[model samples]
Target: MQIATLAIIGASPPVRLARMPHIELPRALEDYFAFAETEPTRNGRRFSITLPYMDGERLDRLQWWYHVSPAQEQMYEGTGLVFHRTRAIERFCRHIERWLEITAQRFHGEEPIPRLGQQASSVATPASVELTPVDKVVNA
Candidate 1:
């Protein structure tokens, strides 16, 4: 006699990759929001996304990997396991989503800055200069 066990896993959560289009960007990150775009593409047999660097500088390309399920795998045989179903693929997608959120906030300047305008005054300057009245003027 032979014994075999089978297990079933629940369906995965709704996940999608958000795409970003090309646009003119600032030299420094401070002016990022001046040009930024978001583009979304559904996961399909050929599931892959590319992030472009707006600046002219040469840099490594950013790529993401996705895994598809057995059923989906069979449907798209030539596409390979890169886009086939797997837990690692789902985890990668989740991480990418979180990264996108943080990147957007950073580029848009949504992140709060500490002590943006608050500064402490020092007493090193002369007392007369510090106490000078704005309405009063001294003859040269």
Candidate 2:
């Protein structure tokens, strides 16, 4: 199966792919928001949400996040599962595939992706990250 995309030139997190056949993003997202322990960030062109979930009887353990940046001429936001101790988010994504493995591709597939803005690698980052009140993120 072929994957199609409409990439905006010079955009940080370019427009989301036109859906992949093997990936179940809808079910993945539904599982993401259903019972995610959300940490609200500032709103506007730049915002982020960090969810640390261990277990909820109905939800699985997943360190996930969703973020958007303004400085990169970003017309779209970014999201994915956190790499926690070799744990695959596919457990929540309802599909079998590493999140970044497939996403980190395109013309720049072979290049080393830069680590921008201190993005978290594992389920936990340093204390420099500040957290605020939880709010429903409605991007419009």
Global lDDT for candidate 1?
0.34
Global lDDT of each candidate: 0.34, 0.31
Candidate 2 lDDT, 12-93, residue by residue in tens: 4433323433332323232233233335345423222222232222323334433332333232243212222012222433
lDDT of 1 by residue, 1-140 (tens): 22112111332332332332111122322212121213423443334433433222333333454434445655544433433333334454355346545554222213221111112334478656455458877899
lDDT of 2 at 68: 32
Rate residue 93 of model 2 by lDDT. Answer: 39
RMSD of each: 18.1, 23.3
Best by TM-score: 1
Model 1 bad stretches (over 4 Å): 1-46, 73-140
How does model 2 score by TM-score? 0.21
Model 1 worst lDDT window (10 residues): 28-37
**Residue-level lDDT for 53 in candidate 2:** 32
Off by more than 4 A, model 2: 2-57, 65-96, 99-140
